[model samples]
Target chain A: MTTASENFDTVGLKQSIEGTFRFRKWRSIAVPFAILGYLIYVFFAFDVAGLASRARPENAAVLLGDFWSYKTHITRDNRSGDVVASVEGERKGTYPAGEGPEWVAMGETTAISLYGDASVQYLPENTAVINVPDFGEITTQVNARAVVLRLPDGKDIPEWMSVSRNRVSIDQGNWRFSMTPARTEVFRYQAGWELFFFTLDSPFYGKSVGELIALAIWEPRVTAEHSNIVAMIDGFWNNKMWRHGDVFWAMGETVLMAFIGTMGAGMIAFPLAFFAASNFAPAVWLRLTCRRLFDFLRGVDGLIWTVILSRAFGPGPMTGSLAILLTDTGTFGKTFSEALENIDNKQVEGIQSTGANMIQRMRFGVIPQVLPLILSQLLYYFESNTRSATVIGALVGGGIGLLLTQAIITQKDWEEVCYYMILVVLTVMIMDTISGWIRKKFIKG
Target chain B: MTAHTVSGTAEYLALVRRRRLYGAILVALFFVLFASGFTVAEDRNAGGFLDGLHRIFDFPKEIFAEAFTNWQNLPRLFVAAIPSLIETLNIAAIATLFGGLLGMALAFLSTRGLALWPRLTPVFRRIMDTMRAVPEIVIALVLIFLLGVGPVPAMIAIAFHTAGALGKLFSEAAENVDLKPVEGLASVGGNWFQRIWFGVMPQVAPNWSSYALLRFEINIRASAILGFVGAGGLGYDLKTALQWGQGKYDQVVAIFAILFLTIMIVDHLSDRARQRLVKGGALV
Candidate 1:
């Protein structure tokens, strides 16, 4: 009888184990197939096949080029018969009359040098000559009715040059030439940002680092009223092209929004959390009301809060900060209340034994227990909110986000966008490091 | 010994007092900075905070009045917003799915014990860090330029970000997994992929899924925001209706309600799911 019972137990155990393995086997196979099915549906829904035709690879090329290079436009107004050379063709980047980059010689016939020993000369009568080394000179004339083209050595037109009715264009990666009835233009692509340190008007615009250092140490004041060092700083700080002062101010506003928002949320939520915490709540009804209020605030979402606040306060860092404050208050209230509820009862009981009032008991017992958790939460949010502030800043038209969007909208300022992207990333990482350091020193220790 | 104890008490008291003084200074400094920062923010704003604070409810009041008058249209408008809301969710869901898959791969490649190439662990870690640091809006805007205005741009942007963010969380979770199973698998003839898949994945899957669910919540909000910036979803709908102003406010209210309800529902669902996932994780 004992042997038979043991045999029965062994079979039952084996059957149970087999059942579990069968379920696992089914799940392992089913989950992947379900996921694959969903992805296939998304593929069609996103119109990914259509994306191939819609995508602008050319724009990507332009963006990549603009990130590290600047183009100097040498153009002659066909009717006016005058050539002007400007970096990025911005008014602030325009060279003074009769002067241009070293490679560009401004005259009746402007000779602009290009890579590969190529050169473009704007000559008499709405005509331009482009020299392509390893190839021959290609001359194109913009007449009243049509563009007349001549290839070097009677060579067939290369695919790089596209000509249409009354217009002609030559495309080389480093340089480009275009002529219409209105203007004959040659854009000479150069490496690096144009006048990054000093604008066109600054006397110290083209000086090397060694010369700049020498000027700073011993040279006479470049501007009579200010010393060389001051003038140099003035040029850089007030640089119109880069807008260094504005960019720094924007960065400060972004950080400021995060600081005020996170701390302010902590200040407001700390008191409210006590009301919401189940163990600490004076009345059940009060706890429910506080929790519901938090739910409402959180449910409203930061985007909606931002829109509503911007309507009230108008667009700026103030509105952005307020939006962050309201959203974080909800988050902090919920988390802090949970922390309060989880505290050791003995500590609170000990504080109560001293006949301390509610406020004192909370201050002495509850706060001591929860302060580390609260502070760590605040620091984490503060670091994240810095990044959020950029987004909020974009929406409300205030901080680095605004500048980034504006730069992106201009499309030509991809380099500026790249700069702002780097700055934003660096600022976030710095905040992350600082918060980690603080957390280590105070909370962990 | 008594003398030593007495002196030690006094020294400890002195140290405590000095620390309190430093704390007081920090608190005072923080208050000053907060106050000044608010002032600067107010000054830079187009309108004064105090003046605008009183008028805060005016826009909400207008929207409510308009919506009340158009009460009958509310249901239809609500129904109309469902598709865009779905688009928003789709953007988030797709992003979370792709991001989770990429993140899982990246986590395995980066985790110390589970890494396919141990020498290149730091390289993969830095790549993940760089990816995580970039804000979604940056990528969304850049993709908008390349892809034109669509949900695809927002989806891709969010996925790119979700990958990096989830990858970091997943690697951290994977780092703490018991290595015995990994060794057990390797003792047999299991390769690197098999070792990670059979040994490491089961242990970390629960924690990683919980993080991904939380990220899905975040990506939803991100998708909506990206839409407002021209990625095309519920946010774009809200933006257009808001732009129309007075008469169209009923539509705005509908969009807002739909978004709020969706967020609340998602929040509750994900919260419950995470609780279960975590509770079950202990058993696994």
Candidate 2:
């Protein structure tokens, strides 16, 4: 009877094992299928299918091209018959009167060379002629209230040319030409940011690197008022197109916001953490209240805090910093409190065994153990908050983020957007490096 | 013996005094920086700090008063905000899901011992760093220009950032995983994928999930903020209501309540879940 019962028990155990294996096998299949189903649902719910139609590829092309290249506009007044060349058509980048880019031959008829034999000539009387290597000369003239177009012999008007009653436009590979009753314009696309270092009015506008270096080192003064280097520095600093001075100050403000916010939050949260920590607080109610206050502050979110603070502080770096301070205070409070609760406590007892009072004991014992953790956390938050401050700066209308948003909003200043993006990325990376260095040096030491 | 003890004591006292002096200098420097920074910020601000201090509660009081007067409409407004709130949650969820998966791949590819292409580890690391460096608003604003104002742009932007951020954390966890199981699997002639799946993944999944959960919390906040800049979500609605000011403060209140409740609930749930996961991993 004992052998028979043992045999039955073995069979039952084997059956249960097989049952679990089957369940595991089924789950392995079911989980993936469930995840796939959910993703499909999301794909539809997010309207991924309609996204292609909603997306503007042309805008993307414009943005990408504008990032690394600029277009110089050679525009002629229809009635006055005078041609003006401006980079990006901005007032700040306009070439002086009777002057233009080297590629353009300035005279009664301005000839703009656009990449390998394809050129546009802005003749007098609001007339323009575009010559292509493969395609013959295409001429467009503004006649009274209308634009007239003439194509090459034996060739119909190609798709690259668009003709209307009042306007005619031809889009070659890298060059664009358009003629209307009011104005005739030719846009010549060139690689590299135009007037990035020095605007057209600057004496150092088109100097080679070697020449600039020589001038900076030992060459005679380019301008009489100051040395060559000083003048160059002054010119670059006050560059109207790039506004390097303003940009540097904005970057400083962004860093300042992060610095003030993170340090202030640390100062505010460090003391409160003692009250919140279960091991330190004398009463449960006090700890609970502190925890609840932290939750309230954190739950309000930085965006909401920014909104409220902007109302009080108005829009500036101060408002951004205050928002960051309030939000991070809650974060630091929770983390610091947790750190406090986990401390060893033996050291505290050791200090107490000596003739030290409560304040001295807590200071000598509690602080030394937690200082590294606290400082490292503070530094990490400082680095991360630098990025947050950029976004906050945008909302509050300050810093590089403000400039980035403004450039993006204008929809035409994509080059400036690219510049600001690079600056913000570099700033964050530098902060990350600095914080990591500090943490390693101080905490490890 | 008496002379030696006296000299040693003097040296120790001098060291202590020098350390204290350095500490005092550092503290003084910090205080000066803080004070000067405050003054500069106050000066740059449109309203003086003292001027704005009293009016800080004015806006909040007005909002509360209006909300209390329209208490009957509060429930309706709350109900209306539910869809946008869900959309915000969806954006965060989708971003976290996609980002977590990509982050897992990046971690595997970048981790020292487990990297598929160890020679390219630094390249992958640099890529992650660049991705992390870019603020979400920068990408989102640019995408909003290309894709128009929608959650999709915000989702992609946040996911890109999440992948980079979580990848670093995941790799750190993966580095601590024991190599024994991996070697055992390799001895059986298991392929790279199979070995990683059976060995490394089981070791790091718990920690990875904990990090992903934390990222989900952060991404939720990010998505809401992105909405303020034109992405569709509760933030967009909040912006609209807030722009109307005073009269529609009730709507703003309702939105704020929902956002607060959602954030708190999620925070609590994730905290509990992370504790269980981390503890369970330790037990196993």
State the DockQ of every prediction: 0.79, 0.77
Q: Cα lDDT for residue A438, model 1?
A: 93
**Best-fitting candidate, measured by TM-score?**
2
Instruction: Compose the digit string of candidate 1's lDDT tens values, residues A167-234.
Output: 88988988888988889998888789888899999989999999999999998778899899999999
Candidate 2 lDDT by residue in tens digits, B177-273: 9999999999999989998999999989888989999999999999999999999899899999999998999999998899989999999989998
DockQ of 1: 0.79
Report how far residue B251 has shifted in candidate 2, in Å: 1.1
Segments in model 1 whose C-alpha atoms lie over 4 Å from true places: A1-15, A125-127, A142-147, B1-3, B281-284
Q: lDDT per model, in order?
A: 0.90, 0.90
User: Once superposed on the true structure, which residue ranges of model 2 sit more than 4 Å away at CA?
Assistant: A1-23, B281-284
- Please give the distance, in angstroms, between residue A347's alpha carbon in candidate 1 and its true position after superposition: 2.3
Model 2: per-residue lDDT, tens digit, A1-445?
Answer: 9999999999999999999899879988998998899889888878889999999999999999999899999888888887888998989988888789899898988888888788888877777888888989988888878988888999988899888999888887578888889988888888998888999998998999998999999888878899988899999999999999999889888888888999999999999999999999989999999999999989999988988888988988888888899999999999999999999989999999998998998889999999899999988888888888888999988777788889889999898888888898898888888888988887862
CAPRI level of candidate 2: medium
The C-alpha RMSD of each candidate to the native structure, in angstroms, is 2.3, 2.2
